[model samples]
Target chain A: MSEFKQAEHKLLLIPGPIEFSDPVLLANATPGTAHTSPAFIPVFGESIKLLRKVLLSTEESGSQPILIAGSGTLGWDAVGVNLVERGDEVVVLNTGYFGDSFAECLEIYGAKVNQVKAEVGNIPTDDAIIQALASKPKIITITHVDTSTGVLSPAQHISSLVKKHSPETLIVLDAVCSVASEEIKFDEWGLDVIISATQKGLGVPPGLSVVLASKRAVEASENRKTPQQGYYISWKKWIPIMKNYEAGKPSYFATPPVQLIYALHTALESITAKPISERIDAHKAASKYVKDELTALGLDFVPKSRDIAANGMTAVRFPSGLKAPDVLPKLAERDIVVAAGLHKAIVTEYFRIGHMGVTAVDRQRGDLEKVINGIKEVLGKK
Target chain B: MSEFKQAEHKLLLIPGPIEFSDPVLLANATPGTAHTSPAFIPVFGESIKLLRKVLLSTEESGSQPILIAGSGTLGWDAVGVNLVERGDEVVVLNTGYFGDSFAECLEIYGAKVNQVKAEVGNIPTDDAIIQALASKPKIITITHVDTSTGVLSPAQHISSLVKKHSPETLIVLDAVCSVASEEIKFDEWGLDVIISATQKGLGVPPGLSVVLASKRAVEASENRKTPQQGYYISWKKWIPIMKNYEAGKPSYFATPPVQLIYALHTALESITAKPISERIDAHKAASKYVKDELTALGLDFVPKSRDIAANGMTAVRFPSGLKAPDVLPKLAERDIVVAAGLHKAIVTEYFRIGHMGVTAVDRQRGDLEKVINGIKEVLGKK
Candidate 1:
């Protein structure tokens, strides 16, 4: 097949469902292929294997990747249902709205959650996390990049600290906004689980919830005293099916989204073709360029420290006396779409722009330049 | 815009992930749009409105439509979490594998389940159903068309019986393989819930799970004394978001699959533009044509009675001494894809063919003809 061209439309500068490459979108438009069709089976199998390469997990590490037909929030349910029994204790390292929601999701499965809450645009410190570990929680969840405030927590550092303090605790990372763009050394960091979505860093349309679990996490689930309560989200039912698929044999627990899987296969192929370090560097450079331009216009960031900010997206507080109506429309008028603030306390006080995937990595697209120009024009920066 | 054209490939005759129309496929290839963009809000709102027309749910009936980014199985979880609280009794009419799985899902949510298992390709008799209902179960789950065995349950007749004997019992229909091809009147039948997927009769690639619930179902969910235990599948979290989107306001609990929703909008518009009754009739005629051809080749169907078989798909036993390996590759050689058997008891004894969507409704495409020719050629019946 030759290169496929995508239809032209407005640039999506929002956090997720970002601009996809022509090949990825074309893959999504494939004619319906049976989930078990030979042509489609390997597409799914290869996709699963490629997920490991993206996360830097080796086959020998016994890290299993799960791709299910749901949004990013479903990943939380998968973690909650598979790992947490009634009254099990879990520690949540809060960064923003997603951290609060993740804790609430775990609570639904009857988990007793103890959150080390961070201020807006910040993450819990290592000291606080270590102190929480003293309480002896079963799992510790940290949001790698909180979409609400664009805060990038130190997942590697936190995972190391958890290992040092509590050897038995499972380290879970919410990487919905960080997977393909961020530098995640799954094995090197001693992380147990990473929950993500297709729309954000993977550069595909939203639908599939991606989860990667280490051998220890799977063992914990297998040894649980109680039966997992969720039929769809349970790892007990899915792990074997995932294993069978990766082995090039078809197994069915549920019907997968065949077209979306094809898209994911193509996206993973593109993502893993180059060194992951290059992708991370590209995202970092693009983020710096955009942040530097915003700063030149005298804008302030939600994250107080530049080191704590995410490389994939930016959350900037609107100038005093300016809100969404005044700023968002001006950008819309310029044919760029940005997101409204999601932090509960400052819902109307700021806005967000995403610069991941093709918009960030494919510099020739000039997406960030257009977004920067639109923001400058809207704010009368000239 | 002029009519969109899809790429040519093999005819997909599997039970789902069926052939899609040009408009629907084009919609799926849409450039990334923000989930909350003004342009997208109307698309989502109109999609919800069109779903009502497809289900024959009148506005006065207060039937609420929910479109979530997940597979059809998620619908079962939605019903279990939202309405069937712990210790609640639910009766399942088991026509095939899906009914067994649905019962298991309800059980996962702590529902006490009683199943009336039908013989393969058959449904429970009225007397048996009445006897089961005598226990006054809180809910009755029925698979409208069991994809495993292609058995079509008498939903209207069963709904009428439930209304006469147990007026308060909620009736949920699993219409994953039946929706557009089968005739269903949600209001007239008093169906509390109908669960479906985009890949089947809807003629779109799978990703989105489509559900419609009655006002009574909504009230049952709302009046629950205990908090819902699911975060992503909770109706409480989804209902308000659905309400806001339908009212042209953007609200999000989790990100919707924006491109898939756009595809659903196009498919619904196409389905609704023509009289729905006409679409059902077209599917019926196509089914008759395919079934007659199979019978001519001395093939027997899983469903003993023709009336009990689904119009959208067929499950036919392999001739004695012939199995999947013997038959599947022959059809594949002819560029046709069919599904392997799914019913545990008959996993290798039969195969399934889908005739819904463009394959059945748009006769000019000759999809069924190609499938018929391929099957005849494979069996050496020329």
Candidate 2:
């Protein structure tokens, strides 16, 4: 129990399951405690309260937060199975691979999905969205930061557009990669839902699928005539449990991932103790530092414009004649790890580096420094 | 960093989130590593292979193990959404609370469910099962050990009966409470699916939903005409990923719970290092010891007979004029943690104690001794 120091290992710079803070990892090493214990109830409740703050939503905003035991992809299932009824028309604003997957998930739930797919590393334009909205879609899905291309969709602009053009349309933002690292105004933007995970910008290991539902979304779920097609991910069962926990009462639907929730509690505490603006600014600063160095190395990015690039990660094209194996191993030898491309069309053409959470906010670890130097050394750049 | 040693705390004697071994807890404290890393691939691959051994499955038996990031309930969702198609007739044998939940999950997926109920601590008898099977249900669901009542259903006998009478009926066993603590011959018993979680008998912190699918279940998933209503829990997306990982190739459909999987890897290694029979025997001996001590104090059990009781845990009725608060607090003062009642009809009538994993098997920790002593002190029954 020697103060819970993380063991020395190669720096993890992947998009998720990223390098975690000492306190966060240590929190996960807690002794086996019952989910229903008095000590754990408050931990879970406070975590729920902290989630509202993370999204800049107050009690008056009438938003509910969910903490379920699943990966971020399960968030898509929650949105699909709960929100989209059979044959409901949904507009999916596709930025990259994650967008494609989300569209497919909605279709699985019997939704008639209209995917407005963007070219690699780009998001759909507002005009295109306005056109899609003309069809009077029931819901519009946006990937805040698609991990595959490190492309950040204009969520704020899209949310505003949806509110003005189609006041009844529900706006769902997939913020799995952007929650703590980028700016999101749940109440101000009138977002119906924000789906995220404990990993990535939350500075915790991956497991819990964290979701926030606005008043409108919950109302829609309540008024839907059709029964929910799924059970574990259904909003109906989770709503009561979430409400009980937030009101300082312990309730159970399914056993929550006890240790992961504890870790999320510690991570959220670290993220919320400081102004969220500072965290987002820190991520931008770290992202700029890495991007600037990579640009100087004559590397090109997948994203066409810097404005569209995500603050938490950078996807850069590999040099001509060099595939992932050529450069990844060199970085691995230098005790650093990065991600290969995920966009199916250009998967071998690019690689991604993540600078979120502690790796971005707590620079004392010099993780970014090592990553910069490792890449420079690997690419024969001074 | 030093090796992980969990800080001393009260002994966790609940049914799940059991006391983990030092090695298992240490494995969870590992520094964050990418799920697709070369080092992680083999670890995950080996974990899959080890699951087969734990279930006593052979490679040629065509049983596939799925490791998903979720609670035990997700395992039920996996079975429901994938195996039980719309309007499919399914028979659910109700042993306790978990059976009710599983039946509800199947109904959520549009299955026509027939639940054969038993008394508080007993499982549905062979005659009742034979009557239910006469309807020629597509799947027969059995809870190996219903955690709420510590009732062990006769999985082997039920499996044999299903194979004998309804040869095509898929036998799905909810083994969340029994997997590592009891004997399950996955191949020999001809089970189609065995759903479990890491927190229970696997002796790891809760999160991963570990499922084993037989060839028939896989075929059922594949040959179904109606599209899968779920995406995250769908076998179609996960089957390729599981196959790829088992083949030692890292593939991603969703980000796996990296830390919990590592913990499971360590826990499984410890469980499989010794003969599985010894582990089951240890659980039985521990259960007898605790039950004997309680019986000497004139306490009754929810389970009507020792043969029907689960080896991993015991559900004992409270003495006259005593309730959970009266006895549990005193036990907590002695640093022993147990569980309150869960069966709805007799919600306040009993409490449960878990004697699985290292608490029951290792014995060196003297955890069971503390639990027995704590209870005796609480009841003034030395």
In model 2, chain B matches the true chain B with a TM-score of 0.98
Q: Which DockQ values do the candidates obtain, in the order shown?
A: 0.79, 0.87
Q: Is the docking of candidate 1 incorrect, acceptable, medium or high quality?
A: medium
How well does candidate 1 match the true structure in TM-score terms?
0.98
lDDT, residue B297, model 2:
89
Name model 1 segments beyond 4 Å from true. B2-4
Give the root-mean-square deviation of each candidate in angstroms: 1.2, 1.2
DockQ score for candidate 2: 0.87
How many angstroms is residue A115 displaced in model 2 relative to the true structure, after the best TM-score fit?
1.1
What's the C-alpha lDDT at position B194 in model 2? 94
User: Which of the numbered candidates is closest to the native, going by highest lDDT?
Assistant: 1
By summed lDDT, the worst window of 10 consecutive residues in model 1 chain A runs over: A1-10
lDDT of 1: 0.91
